[model samples]
Target: MVDFGEILTTVGDFGFFQKLIILALAFQNVLFPIFFCSFLFIQSDPERHCNTDWILQADSNLTTDEQLNLTLPREEDGTFSRCQMFVPVEWDIGAIREYGLNETTGCRDGWVYYDTLYDATIVTDFDLVCDRSNLAEVVKTIFMAGLLAGSFIFGPTAESYGRRRTTQLPVVLLLIFITVAGVSPNVYVYMVSQFIVGAALGGYRINSTVLEWIGVTKRSLASCMSQMFSSVGQCVMAGLVYAIRDWRRVQYVLAGWQAFIFLWTPESARWLLGQGRTEEANKLIRRVAAINKKKIPENLLDVTGEQEVQTHSGNLVAHLSKYMSFICVLVILRFSLNLGYFCLILNVGKLGLNIFLVQFLFGITEAPAHFLCVWVLELIGRKKSLISSLLAGSFFCLLTLAFPQGEFHVIRAVVITALVTTGKLFLNWGGSVCMVYIQELFPTSVRQTAVGFGSIAYRGAGLLSPLLNILAVYHWSIPIIVYSSLTLTSGALSFLLPETRRKELPDSTHESNTCNNCI
Candidate 1:
């Protein structure tokens, strides 16, 4: 019986047909970063102060600075208190200014946020500051929960139903959920909508299956290219956030952009072949051949051992039993990467610089990182690539602690930004390498299931990443310490993983277990 790899040889692998499919998927990826990275701006803690405008009633002539000076206490850093104000008195302006009202209380009105980067965000609109500050991070965690929920629901669905149906349905749902999130009347409603958006995103399982359509030699290239486009999406989102500072408007634009992905949702022929739908699989192969301007033998899939096809559809439990050790290591590595990567990305605003430029620089760095990952994965192989990048990321992550805390200086900000950006660059390299590495580790039947396991581990880490910022309350460097520690341990653990460079993707558990070149 001819396997799908042999058929791809006849169908012109990595030719016009595969390139067109990749282009469509790449365009869809460009839209994903709007969701992945939007919160860096959407939920930012902008510069704020208590709305002491009530003091203006007593002193009508007082300028804005004068009003704040009389009404609010100043911190050691010389910034006006964000949540406190002096008790109002009927005394004249001269007497209040002379006495300097000593009684302090929480703002009876609200806050005045002079956010330099954003005119309005969920933080400003909903007053998620001071007491309610932690709520913003809670919302991010809930969204990641939605992603985890979606992965469990849709990852299996893709294995059972076709990839095209599973992918296309979520695009429509994302449009609806994101629209609701844009116009959410309250934070509760917005949280629900964003959770649904995360769920929809989880359901959109496009990346793992992209390799099923291409040949082995092109798998790394396709994986890197898809991630590069996602990086491009981050850059585009940075520009979009700069253009439209309103978080709600950013949501509306992202909602409208979901329509583009609806144009293309191709099924994986290898998946079809594994499902034992020979006729459908043959038609897709012929179509691929036709698009690539190649001719295939008429009886390409005519001879088949039905039992061998059944082996490609084996259940996840059976496959897991055979490869539990490898998969567990992958899950841990994924968790470490997600925790470290997101902790750094979400903290971009606190770098004390132009947030938009910093965000853009972070996104742009990923492009070169992806390219470098492809080179390293091809040259040094997956195991070494992951170890080296993770170690390098850990070093840069530690470098963030060199400067003192609680004070912002231009030189300090520059050094911090450079260190964090360089760390992100290497972490992104590890991420891209991990993705391709996962695809190679599992067989066709259980690939999505294995990816489901990795996603669960990572999304759980993603949920915790935002909350890790709370560690800053204890000490500013605590979160950085945590991120560096996890990445370092993950890098050390990577030695247990085997390399699979330029090897055929395993078709079954037996194939995966018995492969001699997996070393």
Candidate 2:
């Protein structure tokens, strides 16, 4: 009996048909980050200060700055305090200014915003600053929590229901959840919607059987191309933020964009074969064969020894028991890379550049990073590529500490952002290639399941990234140090992973166990 892998090789696995599937699925990859990182723009807290209208009313002659000085308390460095005001007094504003009153308290008449870039955001509209500022991060964490839950749900389904249905399920759910988030009546509703959106994204990206559609040899190329679209999505999201000042409109635009993906995506023929639906699998395979202008021998169509196909699902527990250690390394790598990557992304505003430009730069960098990742993976192989990328990312993180953060604020921001961007770029560059590396590390029977295990770490780090932003406020260099340490440690551990540079993919547990470091 011909195994499905042999049939795929016969059908021209990386041909026109696979390319169409890759292109359709790339949209999903793009949408994932838009939802994941939407908080950067949508929940941004702009500059604010206590309302001084009472002082203004008491002295009509006072200028805005003068009113601010008399009513708004000043910090040690002399900037107007953001959350406190002078206690109400019987003295006129002129008397208050002349006497220099010292008593201060929180604003009783709400607050005022000035010089804010966004017309509306969750922070400003919901007043999630000061004591409530942490809620912004809480909502962000809620999304990651959903993703952790999804990693479990989608993995088995991707194996059983097949990749096409698994991919479509999340896209449909994303559309629904994001729409609810856009129209949410309050922060409570929005946070709940964000959680569901996270779960959908986790299901899609983590359990991605997208790479399984093409030949094992072509997996790197397809992943590179799709991730380029992921980068493209990042740039597109920045443009969306720039054009649509209102956060709701941005969410709506992204939700509307997924409609095309819901309509056109194709199922994985390999998955169909695994489910023992050879007839249905061949129907799709024939379309691929036609697309590639290839022909199959009539006898090759008959699939027998179909016992393995029928029992693949039941075989997972047996497969994983032997491959647990290798999967653990991958899970750790996922956590480390994402923790550093997202730490920088979630704090883009603090980088001291035009928020749109900084975000656009972050997105644009990933395109080249994906391409570069593929090239490096081909040249040096997976093990060295990850080590080199991680080590360099660590070095750059330390390099940021040496940057002159004195007085020239714009110059300082630009320099540090450049360094941080390079650091994150390499982490992601290695990460893109690592997907193929990890997938190749396992037998075909349990590849999606292995990916699910890694996504747990990936999403867990995502959950931690927003809370990690708190470290930045205590000291800018602290997050850089923490991220660098994690990447460095993971890089050291990566040296122990077996390289899969140019080998045929193992098709079963017996083959994989004897491969990698086993021999």
Candidate 3:
């Protein structure tokens, strides 16, 4: 039987053709960070005070500071209350100033946000503060639900159809939905738009799986490259948000970028061959050969290998039952990584520092971490790398508990910020390593199915992460404790999985079963 890898070598592995595909796919990955991290700024609970400006009718000569002092109650910390204000009374300015009214009520007029960083965010625009603050987490949860739905839809669509069609369609949908989200008239409309945006983002995982066709030697490189591009996007988003301040404009910029990019992307020839489309696969191979200046025999793909593999690919349930242990561990690890990584990211505003600077640090640190992850993956192999990164990430997550919980101190805030950043970096590294590891561990016949199941777990954790972050209001240590526990458990269980470094990708259930025994 003529394997696709053999055909790839005959043409050229990691040649110009492969590099171009990687670049296109990696560019799409940038959207992951943009969408995921946008919440940090978009839902930011910025400094706010009650809208007590009705007093200005009587106190025309009062300064801004004087109006606030007269119309709002102060907390023990000496800051004006955000949700409460002194009841308005029709009295002269001098009389009210001397009498000092004490009755208070909810900010009936509304809030007056003092957000110097952003001119408008979902929180500010929608008034999702005080009693309405819980809505912010609900919006994130809806987006994650969309991600989960997309995983279920796109994963099988890629397997039944082709990877390129499934991937390309989402890019177009994402652009349209992002534009809708940008100009949303109200919170309800924005939530729906965000859901569609998340569904579109799910296509990126399918796009990434397309790169698995490259030879094993460059598979890690491809994975790391995609991750680095995502990190770069995070940095770009930080700069854009810093400059624009308006979340709507930021969404517009992201949508505009999508319109021009990804016009012409190539299909995965390996996937075409897997679907028994010999002529299409042959033509793509010849094109790659021509671009790489290599020649291939006419009978290069003359084999029934792919058809035989397809017979075993039909029943996802059968694969799940057959490889229960391997699939479950991958799913658990995905859940753990997603939960830990996003928990830290969503809490960026909680860190008592400049949110933009902290977010930029979060973005900038990822490139080096991914570089280090690739080196670690090459040095110790996939299984060990997963274990080490997860455990290290857990350690950092645990260290966040050391920060004082009562009040925000600059020194404590700085230390906790560093701890969370380091923790997030390690989890991000684990996620990058896990991306390649999933492609390598499963047989080609059931690989996408396995990834789909794992993605369900990943998005499930994403759905929970924001809700879990809300628990911080009760006790600051609650979310960190939960994150650390899950990460530690995943790291410990990673010992049971097999290593697949430098090994040929399995094409059948029998081969995958053999690989499963190698641990």
Q: Against the true structure, what is each candidate's TM-score?
A: 0.88, 0.87, 0.89
Residue range 115-142, candidate 3, lDDT tens digits = 4577888888888888988788888899
- Distance (Å) between predicted and true CA of 491, model 2? 1.9
Error of 1 at 162 (Å): 2.5
The residue-by-residue lDDT of candidate 2 on 433-496, one tens digit each, is 6678777887667877888887788888888988887876777678778878989998998977
What overall lDDT goes with each candidate model?
A: 0.80, 0.77, 0.80
Pairs of colliding residues, candidate 1: none
Expressed as tens digits, the lDDT of each residue in 1-519 for candidate 1 is 677678888888789888887777667778777885445685456688888887777867888878888889988899888888898888888898788899999877888888456778888888888888878888888888888888787777777887888877888889999999889887899889889898888777433335877777888888888789888888998899889988888888888788655346667777777888877877887888899999998777686436447778666677667777777888888888878888887888789898788889888988877877777788888889999999999999898888867678998998989999999888878878888888888887877777777777777887888889788888988888988898999998898888889888877777777642343
Which prediction has more favorable lDDT, 1 or 2? Answer: 1
Q: Which lDDT value does model 3 have at 332? A: 94
RMSD versus native structure for model 1: 3.7
Candidate 3: global Cα-lDDT? 0.80
